[model samples]
Target: MLARLGAISLSLSMILLLSMNYGSFALVGFLSATGLIALVVLHPWTARLTDRHGQGKVTAAAAGIAALSYAAFLACAHWKAPAWTLFPAYALAMGSSPNVSGMVRRRWAHLHDGSTRRAANAVEQVADELCFLSGPILATILVTSVFPEAGVLASGVLLVTGMLLFAGQRRTEPPADPAAGRRESSPLRRPSVWAVLMPYALVGILFGALDVTTVKHTTSMDSRSAAGVLLSMIALGSAISGLAFGKVRPRSEPRVPFIVSVAALAVLTCVPLAAARLLPDSLPAIGAAMFAVGIGTAPVIILGTSIVQACVPEARLNEALVWPSSAITGGNATGNALTGWIVDHAGDSSGYWVPVVVGPAALLAAYAGLALHRRTDDDCVAAEDVGV
Candidate 1:
């Protein structure tokens, strides 16, 4: 989760930093686009590497590269280097980011199965929500209160530090399954895997768009500092619900909760529009709406992660789970670039429309998955078909 802090914190910090320093959301978005491309391109290779080598050795190597990348990015920012230089440097940093969050889930899955796994997934979701809850607030506060460079610097520090610490936790690492290396069935080739991943890709877009838009929206009102707090409200809502969700037992198929949460998220996204229309100018009102919209975020995430864990075999868990993480970061990259440009050309208010539009698209993907796979409630049973 520390790596997540670095990633998300960097995103929030960089979006504001690049836009404020460069005064070009289009440029910022373009930079984010490069990152999105790099992440997607490297997805399979990274997953395979983790599968073959264990998480610790791979993560340590990645952490070293990431440290160098962060230094390069900071140097560029400090010197006001040519815009062209930021793209590769930032992409390297983003692309090399270790998936410690995914590793944590792997650890939990290693220890538990059945109803217990659900609880662990719920806790993992809560940890994620907490990161979201704290990441922006910590990042922005540092940037706003300390030095303009402080947020990115702090994010980099947390990322490197968190990763090294996690890498050292060798005891909890999943046993290196030798057969996993020889497995022919890639998670990408599975229809059931894609069934869950597709809707999540849109969900990633929703999260990314929401971040860029919220910052732009609050910044427009001269309450730029309030951006972190309003953003935290969204995480706060999710964290609260995540806690409650952990206690309940599943009553239906995994897809049922998946669809319900997506639908709720799609519908609650409207709360922001309604809040804006009614109050027209209150930051508090927008904060309230953001919190409500966040309510649906965790349930969808918790259920989605649980679904992936259940469907994929233990050997391929890393390969399969990485896709959802990829979707989020890749989607975030897409959201940042797209919404940043929309805010630049159209108007700040236009950024708000992104989530409203993307939310239902996620719901559609969820329903489509429902029809396509129709997997039973026994989705918890592992499917090992692909390793032919």
Candidate 2:
């Protein structure tokens, strides 16, 4: 129940906050990038707090703060606040965004050991995919069909409610570990961790490009009204994969699925490019292509995350999880900047190719990371075998 509420809260908040007047896509992108950087910098600290105090307390506090930020955004919209003021406010809100998915996975790890843990992780992944799939669609309906600010209002309510509920979940809190809480591993010293993080960073770039591509394509097709529907399709695809993964028996070779998923993503990214040629001028065609892309996305994320969790130490799990999340944020920033520039100069048609190029690059990076990760430790297991 708490997990459901938490997901609803985040979904509501993102739909409300992001769907607002994005006067300058470039500015919004830059601000988002800054916000992601802030999250990255603060993630380890937040994780440390969770480790020491409890995941519930930290998550609730973060969600509550996030709720206030959404409320502030509602105020800004009402008053027609200047960009200067709004940007900082939005940045602060984004920076403080809860790493809810990571926290949930950590709890799953805590609840189950060995194979059971992997199954739990898979369930969590499915939950995340379902949230992503549903959250935006609901938010979009409320914002577009009802009122622009309705999304924000809904988000604020959900955040406060969800976080409070999540905090109350007996199973959600991290186990008390004074020693683990006090222990610190200098991020700078871990070259092995960096190797895994680099590819994940590339994946983040893909995320950013994808975000811009989706928005630009939908707007260009004059189907901005259906943007949420398009995004939901993608999320649905992921949720399906996650559910299937959870029920499957563990595999001995996790990298195989990871590599296969990235390769599929690379192929799927070309859908946009293909749409440009095949449909040439059809909005429906573009939407169809996007749905296809969504079909290929979920397994990649779920498997990639599972591998990362399996590879990292239990003690450093939260910190390790933050790297991937930060990489995603960094990618978003880069994609937004690049996409914004392309849209400004070239036209929306050119924007379609960005993911086509980035996807392949990400595939290569993922393969390299997998190879390197395999060389590190004796107990380092494959993602499939670990059921991650």
Candidate 3:
């Protein structure tokens, strides 16, 4: 949660500063996407090293690199650096950060199984929402009260502190398995993998578009400061629903729930567009819309994560888990860039369509995953019964 707090804080926290520096929404989008691209580039490699070396050593090293990157960011802010310098530093900051959240999920999978693991994942999903729940609010307070650089600086401190403590828990850590490194096939070879990750990427788009859209909308109302609080409303709804959703164990495969949740997400996402159009002057209405839209978030996420966990081999678990995250990163980059462009061209409220448009694609991907998983499961079940 701390790790996600640091990562999520970046865009909103430094947003005003980036606007001051670049003076263009498009540039901000490019820079944000660039940073996420760096993260995507490093994910697979980081997972491989974590598998080969051990989570503690690899996470510690990544955290250290992230610290240095933050230091570089601090230096740039001090000097009032140009976009060229700030862009790369921000990219490095994002790229170098450890996959602490991913590590946590992998650990959960390592430590638990079956329904226990599902419940654990559900709880962890709530925790993930909590990180996001507080992250933006914290970033807003620090940036508004302290300084623009405070958010990234705080992120650095939290990243270093949390990762070190987490790594110290040696007994719970998944043991290093160098032998699995010799496997000939890659998890990427499976089509089901794409089925899972594609929706994740779509979900990423939802988040990214929502981030920029809310901020821009609030900014339009001359309440830019309230952006964090409004965003938190969305997170609050997700966390609340997540707690309730976590209690009920699904009696069947997650396919139906996953698809239904994704479908709900796509439909609810359109509410913001309506709110923006009808209640242009009403912040309360807009906030309610955001909260309503957020209801579908945790269910889609928890189900997706659990399904993906079930799909992959234990040996490649870390790597497999990281892929959904990377897909989200990639989707975020795309969403940010696209929505940023819309804000620049169309207007902040019109930018609401970005998520609306992406929603169906996400739903379609979830449906495809449900179909693929069922087919594969049926094939396996048939073979097993015949063998018996």
lDDT of 2 by residue, 1-388 (tens): 3344333433334433453565455655565566566667777778766766777778778876777776676688667677667666666566565666777777777666667876776677677767767666776777778877776576567656766777788755667555764575643345445545666676666656656656656667766666666666666777777777678764555666777878887888788779867876676776677677767776766666666666666776766677777777677667767776676577766777788888888888877876776676554555444555
TM-scores of the models, in the given order?
0.94, 0.87, 0.94
Report model 2's TM-score to 2 decimal places: 0.87
**Clash count (model 2, backbone only):** 7
Worst 10 residues of 3 by lDDT: 379-388
Instruction: List the candidate numbers ranked by lDDT, top first.
Output: 1, 3, 2
Instruction: List candidate 2 segments past 4 Å from native.
Output: 1-22, 181-192, 379-385
lDDT score, candidate 2, position 97: 58
The best candidate in terms of lDDT: 1
Off by over 4 Å in 3: 378-388
How well is each residue in 1-388 modelled by candidate 1, as lDDT tens digits?
7777887788777776776677777887788778776776675567678777788888888889889998998888767789999999988988887667887888888887777778888888888889988988997898788877788898899999888888899998987665785765776766667777888888777767777777877777888888888888888999999999889876666766788889999989878777776886799999999899889888888878877787777888887788888877778778878888898888776777888888889889989887766744344463221100
Per-residue lDDT of 153 in model 1: 91
- State candidate 1's TM-score: 0.94
Residue 111 displacement in candidate 3 (angstroms): 1.4
Write down the lDDT of every candidate, Cα atoms only: 0.80, 0.66, 0.79
Query: For residues 1-388, could you state the per-residue lDDT of candidate 3 as single tens digits?
Result: 5667777777777675566445677877887888888889888888878887899888878878888888997788667777688788888888887677778888988887766777787788778778777888888888768877787678778777787777787999998888766872465765556767878899888878887888788878988778788788788889888888888776656668788888999999998889999998788888888898778888887877776677666777788788888999999988888888889889978778888899999998888877777766622222111111
Candidate with more favorable, higher lDDT: 1 or 2 = 1
Question: What's the true lDDT of residue 312 in model 1?
Answer: 73
